[model samples]
Target: MTKQHIGILALLVIILPSCSYFDFSPDLRFCDDFYVVVEEMPVLIGGMAELQQKVVYPELARERGIEGRVTVQFIVNKLGDPTEVQMVRGIGGGADQEAVRVVKQAKFEPGKQNGKPVCVQYQLSINFRLEN
Candidate 1:
């Protein structure tokens, strides 16, 4: 192909990925079908401290002396609500459930792509430890 044609093709390649052809739909069928990264990732509304305050140490876990981190994966939607929370890593003894509970109750500032709110996959780890 001519240099002019090649140049035009290269320009299209650069522009197409950011175009409406990849439009986001809030009604997407699959929960995993969300952006992993965006121009601005979602932030917890009151930050991690606010979410940590919501955690209730499970009696069984506390009694058993189970202490570790529970990692949760979820999608922060355009509305800044977490959905589809799943445990990525868990230290049993009810810590998994507690982690999920707190995450579901948390709110966030929606992630942005091209200055528009978009769904983004996010991961957070909550630590459980016995206080002296």
Candidate 2:
């Protein structure tokens, strides 16, 4: 083959791979999904101090003298509201219930990923201490 023809063939070979790699099929569509943002945290009713005061000592914990920390997972909605409360860790008896009660009553400022309000999961730790 002529040197010119050979050079043209070599160029085509190098360019072919890149063309295939960059090709986007006309029938295909790509979409990116994103989450909403929360503007502010929800306000807790009576605040954290009031929540602690309202928390009742678990009867089971009192009976068994159990003392430890319980972790609760919940979601703060866009409106700074909490919901879907569940115990990630339990301290047994009334302690669990007390933790749930306090968490439910506690309000968050809401979390945002972007600029819009979105539901975000949060974890809270409740510690029960036995007084001497």
lDDT digits (tens) for residues 1-132 of candidate 1: 999999999998899878998764456323445799899999999989889989999999999999999999999988888999999999999999999999999989988999988889999999998997
lDDT score, candidate 2, position 7: 100
The global Cα lDDT (0 to 1) of model 2 is: 0.69
Give per-candidate clash totals.
0, 9
Error of model 2, residue 100, in angstroms? 1.1
Give the range where candidate 1 is weakest over 10 consecutive residues by summed lDDT: 24-33
Write one digit per residue (lDDT tens) for candidate 2, span 20-103.
676644311111231232354334556666666766777778788899988887777655666778999987878887898888
Kindly report the root-mean-square deviation of model 1 from the true structure over all alpha carbons: 9.6
- The 10-residue segment of model 2 with minimum total lDDT is 27-36
